[model samples]
Target: MNATDFIVSRNDLQQCKSIETQPPEAAALPADALLVKVTRFAFTANNITYAVMGDALKYWQLFPAPKDFGNIPVWGFGEVIASKHPNVAVGETLFGYFPMATHLVIEAADVTKRGLRDGAAHRQVAAPVYNAYARVSGDPAFTGKQGDYQALLRPLFMLSFLVDDFLAENDFYGARRVMLSSASSKTAYGLAHLLHRRDGIKVIGLTSAPNVAFVKSLGCYDEVVTYDAVTSLPADSPVAYVDMAGNSDLRERLHRHFGGQMKYSGRVGLTHRSTSPEEPELPGAKPSWFFAPDHIRKRAREWGPGGVDMRFGAAWAGFAPKLDQWLTVTEGRGPAAVQQVYLDTLNGRVPPDQGHILAL
Candidate 1:
């Protein structure tokens, strides 16, 4: 069967194409291999962050592509059209990481009734979370609109959950307030949601003027301020900054404004792509990148097996239902629709409340 992939230029994300190619033959499948038909996936600013940080974070290495082009990874559901593993069967559906393509061939290892890991050689160095897939039947979040919510927000929310857990584990670095930039983005608001629920810590959201109202409507932040108002916040209060926008100027402003009062500066997403990679030494706390996978590994050892899941699952239960009130899902099908959504997301035209679920 022909597989169509949506790939973006590593040098210029705006330059993209949907290329059609031949997939592995189902009949000639290797042992323990499964051919999955890509159903649908969510497109968000998070995917754009993957492309922007592709080289720096090895995101481009996840799925190979032609020279100068890269396949952006996504979270979604797929059906197994062919299977060579005895434990896995055709027609079973799975929810996990997938390329923006029509099909995928997975070398299934560590198979279980719940799911299996993609034991492909190229993916070994990556985080296990990206390689793992869950069976649809076994995933409680796979039902009804919950599945779309899962695809759209679960991965991002997992990052939010981990960041929240990490901060709490460290006693929030002795800061009384936590500030998140790009507050309208999924990950930012997701973190805001968790932080808002906790007492003794104030959650502040930093966003663009256009998104200020939307961010405030989420009602998860104690205060929502625009980018220009960064200096308006009390500079003397001890606070933690979550750099979700990755705007260099804003980062410098926050650091210089707060000076030694900025207890922790944790860099997260790059929703704002027009920024230099080289960080200039500024006052206050040094900026450190928060890699969610590393935190997951640490928690897995500390919390033991299923401990993180139990905690995250309980948190998700509370957060999932809130999406129905906060997000509007928009469905698109075929290559043309997929390309439009990709370009819109890349160009920052997508509204904060709208979520796109595309099928190829």
Candidate 2:
């Protein structure tokens, strides 16, 4: 391909416009630099967060934006077409952070440092949480040698695993029923799957009716409840809640229903709202923010190398098969479809039962 194609975000429709082809040249940098061709990127909640939160996050101060137009941060698998670095060579595949753009050029120096690089290095950085690069692994966790679609899902699985860890670490002493808001969302479904089989935990999934049957098909919850039907729940179930919906009203209802028994409330995502307002008066059961980057970092330090290896590595292996079964892939990465996908996602128009893949 002589020209690289990409989707550029435009304010016109709060949408992305496709740049079908662009002139491609030999390494734009020194000989040691590597040219990476983006393969597939999942339009994930985290990336959406980067777009929506934009310049507002407190941590955004760490990574200054290069331009005013909101940055489109993406994570996906790619192939190295050329490389001057010995560690990475032509034809090698890797997984890492990339912009929504088609072709990316990185110096060997930047490639090697990856996660360690600060905002000063990779300008226009949004989240300090993600590493710049992830070397594709032959480990069994990534579907053997090819990685395939499975590699794209590693980040989602890792977040679910870490959420599980957070519950465990907090001791969950008084925790009883667990309410999963945004029950139709992929992340919520996965978390519910991981916890459903546990001996005593009761899983309650709160979603819309369109998603009710689909979520129930997953069979990972003790009960699937719709947001409108939440009034049917026991007024005092003494529950712990996971708020993925980011709907303040639902958050309030969960707090009120469980009241004092609401032992723990975790806020993991704001999928429902493009941008959520700050809660001046948080509800009865205060929602604790579960930032995956922070959780992983703390665990890495506390568990050391061996601890991380045992927990995350083991979690990845165990969860891989189940994840693959549910993560259905969609084809093509044209920008025209991307805006529709986002719109559907925003209005809860996308089918809750399936996962999405935007092949670039």
In order, candidate lDDTs are: 0.92, 0.64
Off by over 4 Å in 2: 1-13, 20-27, 57-67, 109-120, 123-129, 137-152, 274-283
Which 10 successive residues of model 1 have the least lDDT summed?
Answer: 136-145
Per-residue CA lDDT of model 1 for 1-360, tens digit only, reads: 688998999998889999997888988989999999999899999999988888877878888899999999999999999999999989899999999999999999999988899999888767889899998865656965789999999999999999999999999999989999999999998999999999899999999899888998999999999999889999877999999988999999999999999999999998888888688998888999999999999989999999999999999988987898899999999999999999999889999999999998
TM-score of each: 0.98, 0.83
Off by over 4 Å in 1: 138-140
For every candidate, C-alpha RMSD to the true structure in Å:
1.0, 3.8
Candidate 1 structure lDDT = 0.92
Error of model 2, residue 220, in angstroms: 1.3
User: Could you tell me which residue pairs clash in candidate 1?
Assistant: none
Clashes (candidate 1) = 0
